[model samples]
Structures are given as C-alpha cells and as structure tokens.
Target: MEPWEMREWYADYLDACNRHDFDAIRSFVAPGVRRAHLPGGADAWVSDMADLFHAFPDWRWRRIQLVVEDDRLAAHLRGSGTHLGVFRGVAPTRRHANVAQFAMYRVTNGRIAEFSGSADEVELLAQLTGTDR
Candidate 1:
C-alpha cells in the first residue's frame, strides 16, 4: 500500500481499537498474527484486548505520529484510561493513567501480519499504584 493508504488504514485500525470493536479488529489482523512472542492469532489477540478493555473500560489510544515504509508502519500513540478492574494482579485503583507507546507493524495483503511495541506501562502502573517504577 502507498504511504497515504497505509496512514488511512492505520487510522481505521485505531478507530476500531478506540471503539473496542473486536469484530472489526479481526478484520485488520491476520488469523495467526505474531502479536505476542509466539503466534497467538486473531482470537488470542482479541482475548488479550478484551482483558485490557475489561480493566479499563474507557481506554483510548490517540495517534501522536505515524510513519510508513513499504508495508511497515510505525506509530507513536498516547494511551489513556482508568483502572476500573484488575490488571496483571493489580487491583482496581480507580485511577486514571496516561502512557506513551511506540508500535511497529508489518502489513501483508492489507492486514496486520505482525506487530510489536513498547508501552510505558511501568509508569502507568506506578501512577495507578501510587509508587515510582
């Protein structure tokens, strides 16, 4: 896809994420995507996202910047949400947290084939737990 197409595609994907539309998400990710260290596939991907959604019902990811090269896309985003449910052993703190994340993705046949990223979850966790990381 061209850079403009990729940008539009990425924006649509983020829209799906912001909407927490798992069905829509399935359309953008490969069946067996390498989202985690291992290939978890779209179902697993949705399940993981469900977990996050459960913990932060109002979670949102806003695009800060995006760059496209070939079939690869890099996104810088600012994510914000409230700790309303348990997350990775951390009980609900009802605290709001904002974090920065950078994700790199590869697209194949117009679907996300694989992706990896780093998020400031440590900082978010600290903010939620009232402790420094």
Candidate 2:
C-alpha cells in the first residue's frame, strides 16, 4: 500500500481503538503479526489491549504525530486514562494519568505485520505508586 493508503488504514485502526472494537482492531492485523518488544501474535495483542481497558475503562489514545515511509509507520501517541483497576500488579490508585508513547509499525499486504514501541512506563508507575520518582 502507498503511504497515503497506509495512513488511511491507520486512521481506521485508531478509530477502532477509540471505539474499543477488538474485532475491528484485529481485522487490521496479519495472522503472523509479531510484536517484538512485547508478546507476539494477534491473541496476545488483544489480551494486552483488554488488560489496558480493564485497568482504565476510559483509556484513550490520541495521535500526536504520524509519519509513513514505504510500508513503515511511526507514531507519537498521547494516552490518558483513570486508574480504576490493577495494572502490572499495582492496585488501583483512582488517579488519572497522561503518558506518551512512540511506536513503529510495519505493514505487509495491507495489514499490520510487526510492531514495536516504548511508553512512559516510569511516569505511569510513579502515578500509580504515588511516588515522585
């Protein structure tokens, strides 16, 4: 797919996320999708997303920026949510958190084939733990 097409597809995927439509989200993923920095496979991806929603029922992500080159897309995302359930073994703090993430995705045959990203885990953990660090 062209860069423009990929961007359009990405926008739709983001829309699916905003709606918490797991099936729609999975439709954009290739069966062999590999998330190197996290768990691999479509099931794992869905589980991770479900976990996030469980922790923050109102979690949302906004794209701060997006750049596409060939079949690769890079995105700067800002996410906000309220801690209402356990996350990564931390009990709910009921505090709101805003964090940033930088992600890269590789598209193959019009579907997401690979993904890797890094988020502000330190800040998120600090918020949950009520720590300054």
Candidate 3:
C-alpha cells in the first residue's frame, strides 16, 4: 500500500483497538498474521496485546510518532490506563500506570503481517504496586 494509505490504516487500526472493536481488529489482521516481541524469545505480541487489553479495560494508546517506509510501520506510543484487573500473573492492585512503547509492524495486503515492540516494565510494575522505583 502507499505510504499515506499505510498511515491511515494504522490510525484506524489503533482507533478500533481503543474502542475494543474485535470485528474491526479481525478485519485488520491478516489470516496468517504473526506477532512477536522484541529482544527475542518473548511471547506472541498478538496474544500479549489481547491479554493487556483484558487486564486494563480502559487502556488507551496515544500515538507519539509514526514512521512508514516500504512495507514497515514504526510507531512510538504512550499508553495510560487504570489497573482494574489481573494481568500477566500479577494480581489486581487497582492502581494506574503509564507506559511508552516503540513498535514496528509489517503490513501485507493491507493487513498487519507481523508486529514487535518494547516498553518499560519496571515503571509499570512500580505503578501497579504503588511503590517507588
């Protein structure tokens, strides 16, 4: 897809995600889509995102920046949400956390083919536990 089209698609995808529109998400992901985490050996990004949204039902991502080149889209996103549920083996603390992530996604046939990213877990943990870091 063209650069403008890719940007537009990503914007829409994020909007759908924020709204928790599963059908829109299904339409955005390729049938063979694969999601991987950065730093290697991490769990699938697709399932991770799903689990994350489940843990923080009010999560919202604010796009800080985005870069599109060839078939790749890189985005810097800042997210904020309340800790209203358990997540990743962590019990509910009912706190709030803010996180920033750098993600790169590859698009094919107008759908996301792959995705990977990194974020600061230390701060997230601190916020969840209401402890200083």
Candidate 4:
C-alpha cells in the first residue's frame, strides 16, 4: 500500500480500537502473529486488549503522528482511560490516566504480520497510585 493508503488503513484500525471492537480488531492481525509478552499470538494479543478493556472500560487512543514505509508502520499515540478493574497488579483506583504509547508494526497483505512496542506504564502506574517515582 502507498504511505497514504497505509495511513488510512491504520486510522481505521485505531478507530476500531477506540470503539473497543475486538472482532474488527481480529481482522487487522494475521492469525498466529507473535508478541513478546503474550502467547497464543493474535488471539492472545486481542485477549490482552480485552484485559485492558476490563481494567479501563473507557480507554481511548488518539494518534499523535504516524510514519509508514513499505509495509512497516510506526505510530505515536496518546491514550486516556478511567481505571475500573485491576491491571498490572494494581487494584482499581477509579482514576483516569493519560499516557503516551509508541508502537511499530509490519503489515503484510494488509494484516499486521508483526507487532511490538510499549506505552508509558510507569507513568500510568504513578498516576493511578498517586505516588512520585
């Protein structure tokens, strides 16, 4: 896909995420795609996302910027959500946290073939726990 087309596709994916449409999300990822922290590949990745929904039912992400080259995409996103369930061993604080995330993905035939990257978990923890770090 051209860079513009990739961006459009990625924007639609983000729309799916913001909508918490897991079924739609599945279509964007190739079956058995690997992720370091999660096993079961694409299913696990989607499950992890479900876990996040449980923790923060209103979680939403907004794109800060995106860069695409060939089949690779780099995304910078800002997210915000209200904690409603346990996550990362932290009990619900009923707090809202805003965080930045950076993710890199490789798309093949329009499905994500590889996914990697992270969000500001430390900062999120600090905000939720009400502690200086």
Top model by lDDT, which number?
A: 1
Taking all chains together, each candidate's TM-score versus the true structure is 0.94, 0.94, 0.84, 0.93
lDDT of each: 0.91, 0.89, 0.80, 0.91
In order, how many clashes per candidate?
0, 0, 0, 0
Candidate 4 local lDDT, 1-133, one digit each (tens): 9999999999999999999999999999999786646574778889989988999999999999899999999999998999999999999999999999999999998888888888778998999999986
Looking at model 2, report the run of 10 residues with the lowest lDDT sum: 31-40
Those runs of model 4 whose alpha carbons end farther than 4 Å from true positions after fitting are none
The weakest ten consecutive residues by lDDT in model 4 span 32-41
In the range 1-133, model 2's lDDT, one tens digit per residue, is 8878888999999889878899998898887789976778888888888988899899899999999998999999998899999999999999999999999999998788999888778888898898997
Candidates 1 and 3 compared by TM-score, better number: 1
Tens digit of per-residue lDDT, candidate 1, span 1-133: 9999999999999999999999998999999788746447888889888988999999999999999999999999999999999987899999998999999999999898998988777988898899979
Clashes of 3: 0
> Which pairs in model 1 have colliding backbones?
none
Query: lDDT per residue, candidate 3, 6-124, as tens digits?
Result: 99999999998889776777787776666664422123434556778888889888999999999999999998888877876788777788998888888888887787777777778
Error of 2 at 22 (Å): 0.8
What lDDT score is found at residue 62 in candidate 2? 97
In candidate 2, clashing pairs total 0
Give lDDT for model 1: 0.91
RMSD of each: 1.2, 1.1, 3.1, 1.3
